[model samples]
Target: MTHPAAPARRRFLISALSACAVGGLTTSLTACATSTFPFIPDYYTFSQKQVQEAVQRKFPYQRTVSQVFEVALMHPVVGLLPDTNRVSVRLDARLASPFLQQPVNGVFTLSSQLEYDPQSRSVVLRAPNVENVSVDGDAQAYTQQINAAAAVLATQLLTNYPVYTFKPDQLQFAGVTYEPGTITVLTNGIRVQIVEK
Candidate 1:
């Protein structure tokens, strides 16, 4: 009787172990399927092109000379435990300088809200803060200056957009050129340097 019971217990143990192994495999695959792509912490750096495309989609023309606007992400946080993160985007812009041929460089206080969805592995950016500056300069020069300024502003805005499907080379914004494989973006608050590829 004892020998018969031992064999039954051994079979039960084997069945239990097999079931557990299958369950563990399923859980791991599920996590992988839901995980976001390019899991690198600084993946957003590669998103410059996508951001530019979204900006172009948002604004298609450059005919007026009212004020220039741009969007910049401040304190971007990514890779939180689950799939949520927060980032602040400031919209900085200036108007064409009445005295100078180009627009005055100044910081605007516009703010934006960013939300990420882990299940979908996607991020959504919304602009809710905006500040505008008026241009005061020579009429003809200001017109030209504003147009030039707008081109640069558009380029910068596009570079900072939060999506990942667009490319900067496609917009062809004036004054702002992307020298791929030659430009280096620094993290020490240094100005971008463009070199020959």
Candidate 2:
């Protein structure tokens, strides 16, 4: 009876040891996986910043315009959230056509939502809103309406423009000017030549 009991005790110890070893190995593997990429504190925040910086670098002179445009188009709640992975831009632009006498100033706004997948290193852009509009008008009611419409157009334009990778070559429409092979869009279609460069 004593001999049998001793064998049973030895078997229990062996099983316990094996379980502990397995648990330790799992923990070590988990740690290794998590440690492989520790530089990214918050991926969403980083990506948003990258986008913001890119915009700034793209149009450093238009920083103020970009901020206003973005705010107007983005959903107030979505815009305010931290690390929400979205970017918005607003532009107040003035144009004078050599063909026309009067100069025009317009307000444009755009907003976009971006999602990134860490596993695939893939970035996805959701819907965008764009509002293109004339802000200065004689009638107060008309001015308000135009401004509202501009906001909507800006949202759409912003959302789509980023995805379109709008080089200065793809835009073409009636009343738009392209030089040889390139095309560009002017926000105020009525006031200026949409020149390609």
- Residues 66-87 of candidate 1 have per-residue lDDT tens digits of 3432222222212111121222
All-Cα superposition RMSD per candidate? 16.8, 18.8
**Alpha-carbon error at 191 in model 1, in Å?**
29
Cα lDDT tens digits for candidate 2, 110-183: 55555433233333344655533444433223455445545454444443233222223223334453322211
How many Å off is the CA of 32 in candidate 1? 10
lDDT of 2 at 104: 51
Off by over 4 Å in 2: 1-44, 47-49, 57-86, 95-101, 117-125, 130-134, 137-157, 160-197
Give the alpha-carbon lDDT of every model: 0.35, 0.37
lDDT of 2: 0.37
List, in order, the clash count of every candidate structure: 5, 21
Top of the candidates by TM-score: 2
Query: In candidate 2, how many Å is residue 7 off?
Result: 30
Most lDDT-accurate candidate: 2
Instruction: Report model 2's TM-score to 2 decimal places.
Output: 0.34
